[model samples]
Target: MANAASGMAVHDDCKLKFLELKAKRNYRFILFKIEQQQIVIDKLGEPNESYDDFTSSFPADECRYAVFDFDFTTEENCQKSKIFFIAWSPDSSKVRMKMVYASSKDRFKRELDGISFELQATDPSEMSLDIVKGRVF
Candidate 1:
């Protein structure tokens, strides 16, 4: 499906992996990158992975997209899980790459269908676990 605004198509496998993460709890996160004008899966993190593993997958000077399954305990001590859509455009990434990722993010995210939170980050601090927990609680 080519997005009219960005002219980028999201590969079918991306949605499949997202569904697996959302419904089956089969993955900790999914990393995506744009290649040949299409968004494709770059990696799939194991179900028991840590946040550090997810953060480490992103390149220092590139733009990417990801979905993370965040599990946390609420103030009442109730366990909850939320899926977050993250747009990763690091500060050192090329300006053109950043622009392209920004422009296509919405269209790409729309394809995933069940994200509970959306985060746009240019720096690691912006999308830290603390920030995610803050958003949840």
Candidate 2:
């Protein structure tokens, strides 16, 4: 299917969800939880990924968290880190999705933006969230 006047697909909600708080029409939309979208947060080299696990599982949960400019075209350039999004569950014993982020490149290239991501939490007892998860797409 397609939009009435636009040529875009009609069923790409999930892909469109990644959109930032941008304005496209005469009105504006505000999400109650903006931290769950593909918005940018910081470039402060996040807290070293919490690396507290020695037996964490592979293929762990990797949400497309944080989108850096990374304009690698100058000598004074450096890797930047931004928060952009969060998906953490406030009431979970395990390391829940506190937030998520991704690249400005839209690496996944989904029609709708992604919310918080989830992994199996293989070693829920022996992993630090920064280490167990926190890898952006």
Best by TM-score: 1
lDDT of each: 0.92, 0.27
Over 92-114, each residue of candidate 2 has an lDDT whose tens digit, in order, gives: 32233332221222332232243
lDDT of 2: 0.27
Please, what are the lDDT tens digits per residue for candidate 1 over residues 1-137? 79888789999999998999999999999999999999999999999999999999889899999999999888899998999999999989999888888899988888888899998888888889899988878
Runs with alpha carbons beyond 4 Å of true place in candidate 2: 1-11, 21-79, 82-120, 123-127, 132-137
Please give the distance, in angstroms, between residue 77's alpha carbon in candidate 1 and its true position after superposition: 2.2
lDDT of 1 at 93: 97
User: Looking at candidate 2, what is the lDDT of residue 124?
Assistant: 40
4, model 2: CA deviation in Å? Answer: 28
TM-scores of the candidates are 0.97, 0.20
